[model samples]
Target: MPKLRKAQVMILDGILSILMAMTISYVLFAAWPQHRETTGQLALERAGYDIVNAFYEDKEIYQTIRKGFEAKGYLSASEVEYLRTRLYNYGRMLGVSRIDVDIEGSEQFSVEVTHSTPARREQFTLIMPLRGGADDRIIRVSLWE
Candidate 1:
């Protein structure tokens, strides 16, 4: 084996000293507990996205939206009620205090279903097209605790 130069030896010693110091400090102080707030926010956002996708994919919801678009300018009372019920049920299933669904379509037609006033903190909003193809209708789902 080639003999290490003095400079190489000094560098290796410095690296080893740093490693030892780090190990000792870790052993004495222990590992810090990671904060989960960011993780929770990501999960909340994911749930909101899933809810919006469900709304986009559901056949009944699609039919209602399509009919409303084809018919008189906006959704009927029954259709609005159906959407509200669905959003409320989803909120309950997710164990969130409130969930809001806002539907906006072309021609300035909009419908909103809000169960309760949200705290505004720890909320996630997801927006997606109402139908699969190029559709004027878009849905926004907000989930908050």
Candidate 2:
């Protein structure tokens, strides 16, 4: 069964449609799970501006993170519970699985982080196949005295 010669089947169907679109765009932007999410809000605004410039620069962030969260009690540093648990555990190490914050202004206080799924115009389709695009990453932080 060797009767194929229409220019070798149009150059092997254009090289199998460009190697199947580069193997489905490298498995939808590198390995599954409808990912990216605005690079997790630019790594949570660069670790919340280096933790609000290490809490107003130099030192004294609520007495140095309230003496390391009251020596690891996690709460009860005379009040404000270690500055709202360091503004939500530094907004969950920057990935911010989900968050809804509002500090209502102060020496500077405001934050909002919400990301749980590919909701910002979802696009997905993967595994053994070919399509996926996603977005949903919000990070905002402003912490001070």
Candidate 3:
């Protein structure tokens, strides 16, 4: 009778161990895709911020914006083209399929370029003062992957 009881106890232990292993496997597999998607979104967010920051820190961009502000609240066609081209190049370098930039200063400027299909998208906005902090401007960049 003692031996019989021992056999039953061993079988119960084995069954419990198998159940635990199955539970662990299910949890890991179920969460794997969510984890991957979260990481991808984080990367896209970082990229969007980088694009916005580039425009903020660029001397040429500042110069162009200053020129617009000085010109009675409007940017010239050439200045707009220059900004559009620069944004397109940045999008290309970052492997993005589309880029949209919105600049709000003394005037509003918008530019967009679409090159391919998009699988993900992220946007970032920055506010910076122009011309010695006398005026503030908003720049928003959206990147599509």
Predict model 1's lDDT versus the native.
0.62
lDDT of each: 0.62, 0.43, 0.73
Superposed Cα deviation of residue 58, candidate 1 (Å): 1.6
Better of 1 and 3 by lDDT: 3
TM match of model 3 to true structure:
0.64
Error of 3 at 18 (Å): 13
**Preferred candidate (TM-score higher): 1 or 3:** 3
Give the per-residue lDDT digits (tens) of candidate 3, residues 1-32: 99999999999999999988878977877533
lDDT of 1 by residue, 9-29 (tens): 989999999989888878899
Q: What are the TM-scores, per candidate, against the unseen true structure?
A: 0.57, 0.25, 0.64
Predicted structure 1, TM vs. truth: 0.57
Candidate 3: give the clashing pairs.
none
Model 3, poorest ten-residue lDDT window?
Answer: 30-39
Best by TM-score: 3
Q: What are the per-model C-alpha RMSD values against the true structure?
A: 11.3, 17.7, 6.9
How well is each residue in 1-145 modelled by candidate 2, as lDDT tens digits?
3556877888999999988887898778774446555564455556556555544453444454334334553323343444555656655564444333222112223334443452322111111111221221122343221
What TM-score would you give candidate 2 relative to the actual structure? 0.25
